[model samples]
Target: MIKSPTAHEISYGLVELNPDGTIQRANDEAKRVLISEDGDSNYLFHRITNNEIKTKLHECFMGRANEFIVTIDNQPVFFLFHRSNNEQSQDRIHVYLFNIYNLLTLHDHNNWNNHLLSSIGEMAAGIAHEVRNPLTAVKGFLQLMEQTYKEEYSHIAQSELDRAIHILNDLMSVSKPEFVQEEKAAFNVCSKIESILLLFQNQLYDINVIKSFQDETAMVVGRRDQIKKALFNLIKNAIEAMSDGGTLMIEQYEDGHDVHINISDSGVGIPKDKLRLLGTPFFTLKQDGKGMGLAQVFNAIQSNHGKIRVTSEEGIGTTFYLSFPKKSQYSTQFIGGNTMLQVVDSKTDLTDFLFKNLDFYTREWVQYLEKNKSYITSLLKENGEMEQYDRAGNPIMKLVAQNILEIKTELIMDVAKERGVKSAKTEFPMHLAWELFQSSRGIIWNAIKSFYQESQNTLSTEEFFTLERNVNDIIDLYIDSYTAYYVNYKEDLLKSHRETVDELSVPIIPIAERVCILPIVGNVDTYRAKKIREKTLVRVKELKANQLIIDISGVPFVDTAVVNHLFKIVKGIKLLGCSTILTGISAEIADTMIELGIEIDNELKTRSDLQQALQDIQQFRIGKD
Candidate 1:
């Protein structure tokens, strides 16, 4: 009687061999593993006896070897032969066969580890070479200070030395073979991280560190130093990644029974495969890297009963997420009606917390919308044909179509923003609203374009009247809503005044042949200051003016930087052999100049008003005559 093999036995390719080692019965997997479908079972063992493997199998059968590895039909197999009884007649040699596939897999893994270690070693050597110059400079400075000014400026020199030591420590940390030493302590996590960012004050010129803490006093009961080190490692990685520089965001919030922290970098991102093994020891793609930073991060997180997750792409950037269990509050108090009272505490909702504290999204969205509107207005003003459409298939409509197509870009900015704000409940609504607005605007623009095209050929009085009314109605609806919402919500949004028409002036004064004047009408900063410089240069060159007057009477304010930029422009004009007279220093501006101790070089003449400036330039011209 024969029993069928169980699923496990069949799956594992288990088979029992007869005393002589000829095949007694074979499972489906055993047959598949040992012999091809066309090969005969009687001839399978005989066929396997010709190669070097036959010699090994014979050794195993003769009890010369306890186990032998052989290949049958190019498939690797591990054979074990043993006798159940010592007596020759009753003795039966049992042979067990395994595919050795798992052993081969283990071998491959070992080889990969060896390769990874070799690469890491090479990277470590490079890092050492790269950091040595800075280290030497720091060491030399310290020694010189100790010999020259240690007694006089010991405190200051010691501080500089300490900073140098810290940098050296960071470099050594990367190269060190020691594992992370975890010292657990309860700490105000937000405050601790904020302090770390504050240390990078001088280096943050091109970097903006935006901190969003759901709880100002959020605490974590963990290894404070280890967490701080991990945060620094991630931020340092970010700064190095963004060669051009960008924002580093550190966000902290609490989910139900859990505290979450996210450190994101807007820098060169990691490859998907590399990102997967980012926390694996000695896995990095950086030119001079030991790959231990993220490995240490992983260890710190695990030891603290926390989890760390990383998401990255090749071009966009990378984000590190750290989460830990929230601690229970011992007591709660409500200061209401001039009395402090104990109350049943409910875990605060992060949505309500954020809504009450921060609405960066709403402000950012409003600014974005205003900028988009300004861009559209500029396009319309610059391209006259785009603002108007005519009948008879005008060629100008092609330019209009081209401009529209250019403006119709995918609204992916909100996608990136939403990804960063995924864990925030308060921003979710704002993100959705922005996405809807972008989508709706595209649809409406396309619909209006279609309607305009359809009505373009219909020059009949009735059709023309209908089309004109429809276009006006659509535009009015949009403009009215925009004006109403913007005027109500953001009345003082732009620096330019909206209501006082007289307060603003757009006077045109002839400077030279085919040249006119543009009196700057409002406050100017470094950005707008550059614009004035550019406009002046272009107009001066275009007009070939020998004498020009810049009237600044309408300007409300001017800083020293603005004044310096003006002086630079004057010098530039002088290099062109052109004379510049500044005309419009109001009493307030005059007072500001005096208060600020600003002195303008006498090369350029200035007057109390534009008329006086013009008069001065005219007098100079008359004197030249």
Candidate 2:
């Protein structure tokens, strides 16, 4: 026969006291529940059983209330006592206990759900408030424009109307409470940031914003407009934080499977207490702030399955960090097989590619060094060589060494790039290389200390000194070699560029006596172009130059703003009594310039080659003489 289920077999000790409340026998369950294995059962029972409950039970036995129910640790139980009129008159009392763990669990679940719903509702309200004002302004402007422009200017009015409508559309998109469907697309992050900066050009100028971007490109998978909105919020907050004057840094990088965007400000940092509440819906530190900027940032990041962290010190500054998942090759080319094929085909084989481009030069250099190893060895052996090396290892040497370390850092970056990692450039800062070196040194020092402590033979004082000197010498040589190699490589690259520049004889002759060639390198945005123009003008006047050649060969891309600034430079140079020749119009640059609707052909002299510019300038000078 099956035994009764243990559910019922489970028992608690029952304590029944004399009418005077003397000692009573304790049941097994009560004993197990109230006392430890070695605890006194009588003492525990007396101490744990409620005095009021016992008194009330006695009263109930004497016919006060018929029954009573009470909770213990949120568990409900019933206590019943009966008194008989017979001669013995023994008191009969029973205790009934019930478990309510499941009930408590249900209650907690309901509460949590309610709290979550309330939070979502609050977020929705905050979003509506944040977006409605901008939308109202856009709508009002469009309506005014429509009314103001009757007939002839209707086309201009319509263009403005379309722009207003786009703004409203974007506002609606961001303000919606629902999660936006993910649209993973391959887009250049730097280009997107540049576009956003362009959108805020007026504000940037009014505030005298200073910005710098590393000359690198980052590609990521994201909703471009949404990310732009997030970045705008971050930057706008930063600008507001430094109302009088401050610096803002917007940087991106890739680490492992993550792409990070950092927006930092050199302004009054968030208070330590306020930092934790940065992304909360209604949290604000500024008097006039609505506090929705970071909330929206939170939503955007959450929508993208990303994370955000903020660190701030009271007097120092604040840094907001956002991390997005780095897109993989498979995700980047999810649309068509042809796209995947194109990506794969375009990728160069690492071994073959590195060898083909850099290996021959690297190998030749290595061989030359190997052949001259004795000379370097002799230098290394010279007395006080280590000290000399240490003394010469100044900032310039450090910078050069750092640059070499940066090149070697490509080993890490190449892995990320091959995997189609987003924000790879931003993630690998030069400091990380230095940190790695420090870590390696720590490991080496620890090993040496451990060996010294355990060594069977003790080192002589002279031997110890010699070993220390040798280690120092080794470190000095390594650093010096790295610095020398980096400097030499950079010099070689510049030398190559100079040779190429020398071959092209453009029309405008370099005023060797007065003018200096300030060839603008990298992508030229409007702000950079303006700065270049201003700086060149000042230099030209100071040098008392008669001619200037604004070389564009080093420029990788051109936009309308760039072309406009070039025109401004031409005007500025003319004001300084210097003729300007715009040289090195590559096919790509010409195409982009034309696309920008710029009339560079008439505004300034252009040459396909630098030689033509030099010739034209010489001829002009001779004629003038």
Candidate 3:
């Protein structure tokens, strides 16, 4: 009697062979993928040329090993061999074959990525020096001009030149760190990691975060900001990997000698062959990435006396295991706090606990603020503002709760600024606003204490402080943004009172038919520079000018930023079919431009003074006529 074929035989190219390597039976897939056109069963066994693979297959028949890979006709194939357990029939080998062509293609791509990254690192320093040399020489000339002239414009020019040089220095530092350096300090690894995680709160709505932070005082000696930036990139990558939403597991623990942080994600895992190319510069799996993120991460880890190991299986997930040599230090207590930010990674539990008691804390906060019955407070009370304040606490607490739950603070601060501006518009007393913000901190801390007691005091010292700092830091930021906006709005009102209506306008005077003169007389700041660009184009088009003469003779100074603004204005004017003739090139201004390495635009006509510019324009008109 004949038996039915298994699923493996139907799906894959399956073939059954006797112990002596003779063909028993072949599936349709097996004939198409493994067997030759002659339809001989011996061809399958004879195709595997590797002696090691042959030995492994022989062992599979003897009931020892069951999996082996072999190359047949320059193509890699996977074979799964199993011995049949049938009492009535003879012992046979059941082999499942699969083609792994795509995987090898990916391997080839990663190898190319690795080679390209090596070339970039070697060329970085050369590029930096080649760009910086001209700027350095120009800066030297500008210094001499500043000494000879003792002008304010040269000082402005020098400042802008320094900024350009600084950027080049930073580029060189990232590419070749020994060329530039930073100081390393001992910082709380757990708290830093927690803070970085908070930056990704909005993206975590669909993600389930599981944090297992055992050692809160896991100190790592490194450049604090650089390490933070590196961790931010790694976490950002982890979040991007899970587009469909999955588990994000962040664990931090310590052995006797070292502290370890394991960041794992249940996303599309990286293939084994491509893992080595992960930190290579300009290499990325994501569609919209510059690829410097992981490169910086790798550089930071190594520079900070840390090691990173990664393990991943395609379609399963990936984990980054980072170990740093532990820096042993006694915990110091922060003033007004339990212990100095020895924080744990119990983000989910702590956030949920605070949210559960959010209402109680909100009421306590409003009641405390209401005790201040001053004139502003009394006026607000009559306007039903107390209820509004009470109502506002819920959403604010939700934002703060999101912060504790590990979310970004940008939206929270934006809301804070809006509220601050509204308070200013209502003429609310700044001190009373301060008191309102100050009182909430105490109420939230009280709620945290209740959570601790209710949970039977099981919270670790580090875990308690982590929650404390997270709450305090967020409230402090809210207070800063709130107060800043309030004061800025009031100042803007005062500045408006002092200025005349005409002073707010950009001065554009029409000189001739299809020609205009914009004589700029005072210092041009970013705000005024933008206004200048807007009005100049409008006036030029209104007058139907073919030439716009911008005379900056009376203007005090032009920095690098002002130069950029002026260049943009010129470019815009050209796009509108009008020409710009710039006059008043002072010696100080000339030196500044040289130091900034600014090139004169070919379309722009420059002259020593307005008189010379008008002469050239008249001559050009005569020539055209």
Candidate 4:
């Protein structure tokens, strides 16, 4: 039979750069990897990004470092380079690229889904199996409502609730991985094998029953009855295979914390094709076979935390090995509730277990978000748009995933700090920080809640408490750390805002050709007076202004010292061939100026208001003609 292909080819791109760091050659995939639109390879990276990628690529040549993941076109990709010495140029770089988007998409589409539409169609066909009872109940309720109200329109409310039932039916079609709660307890494998031996003792009269007990270390963490039934099936098959007479060998031993039971039989062995399908449902090689024996045997072992492997050659013999973790209830060091966590952690594949189930965690979080979708959306939307918070593929989710892969708390804090600065600079406010923190907490809690829901009922009292406390502590730690980073960044942002506002107060407005106005607003204290003098001179020189208007209409307070500083500013402007045009002189300011020996006319020109000064400058041909 021809089998459909269920695998995908991983995509890769390569580029060879000259010793001097210029692109020499690139393949079609390389152009795609670089997000090049024109398909040109020459000076590509330079044209695309700053020298950041070039620098990082060059660093790959240093020492033995050859590969690392880098973000190219806003997605992570494996950046690898081979440093080979070039005869014509410097060190030649052979670049290789493989991005995360393609890898993850393949895992999602090709590996995860095979004929999804077909499966959905099949599920739709069986939809009646699930919705039958619900529909019956709803129909009965709707009839009751109609009778009670004595009107057909009265049951419209009950009828409308059919959408929820439809949704429930839809959920059943999507297969979530079956997570069976494992109840761990010490059970003797040798005892189970012995029981099977006793059960088959009378039946295996023609066969020679040879049993080997190797040190009797047969304790494993599983239900004993399941093991007994599975072992009995294996032993019975062995006995049945040998109709005339044959040796049925049974051996049990423990290797470290793993218990192994090996069963062998010299009988009419199974064929290669049938051997592979031995445990498949309704599959059998025997003439008088129900086909549920091996399937039940496989399920019994699998359900009780055990793995079974079968090896056989036709007309020779068949051997089976059942392996399971040796019980460690009394052996392990007992702590508080953490005992359960320790057991799970020990049994856990620390490498892939967490990652393999990350989708489950994310899905749970998304479901939670949807549950409160209305409230969250209302809180986030501002001016008809969500305030930095997106319902799909949001930054918080992306960051959480990255953190799941690597402990990027410090990196995250740094980014938060930078965000604070940008937020402060952009006036994005501190509430956004809190928003991300709160939403992330919601996701984390949802994940923990789901995990607890799945296993809490099956865990020991000690393990359950330990798991809850650990989850709480982790959440508290995140809250404390994230708050610290956000607060620090927010403070920095506030400080930057203050400095910016202060700088903006001293306004420099360019009016006409070679003329600028320095509108000094509010009270001119000693500090403001000093800044005014310095900034005025800098503006005049920078703008090449021949004239400057000192508007004091906005300043309510002017002391004798401030008057002297004005004269000094005029003198400084004279030195630069830029004349000072003073405006907004009141009667109070005129008396102070007279006391300082300053002439209002010509010596130090003054006007009642800014319009008068500009008109005077224009009349005298000093302003832009």
lDDT per residue for candidate 1 within 550-570, as digits (tens), equals 777777888877876776778
Candidate with better lDDT, 2 vs 4: 4
Comparing 1 and 3 on TM-score, the stronger one: 3
What lDDT is obtained when candidate 4 is compared to the true structure?
A: 0.62
Candidate 2 local lDDT, residue 295: 72
List clashing residue pairs in candidate 3. 201-407, 514-545
- lDDT tens digits by residue: candidate 2, 1-625: 1111233233333555555444355565554443235635444334555665666665554544545655655555444443322212455344333233332334444554455445556656655665565556656666776678455455554565575555445444444434335454544455456445544544554354444444234545556566777888888777777766667778777767767778888788988755656676655777866665677788787655568888998767789888776655334233333343443332222223322324233333334434645454244335333343334322212222232212222332233233222212223223332433343344334433444565443444433442343333233333333333334344556677755654342223345776556566677777567666666776787778876777888878887677878878888888878776778888877776778776755447788767887787678668989
| TM-score versus the correct structure, for each prediction | 0.31, 0.30, 0.37, 0.30
lDDT of 3 by residue, 329-351 (tens): 32322121334342333456667
Candidate 1 all-Cα RMSD: 26.3
lDDT comparison, 1 vs 2, better candidate: 1
lDDT value for model 2: 0.54
**Which of the numbered candidates is closest to the native, going by highest lDDT?**
3
Query: Model 1 misses residue 116 by how many Å?
Result: 4.2
Candidate order by lDDT, decreasing, is 3, 4, 1, 2
- Residue 240, model 3: Cα distance from true site in angstroms: 15
TM match of model 2 to true structure: 0.30
Q: Number of the top candidate by TM-score?
A: 3
Model 2 spans with C-alpha error above 4 angstroms: 1-182, 202-215, 329-341, 344-625
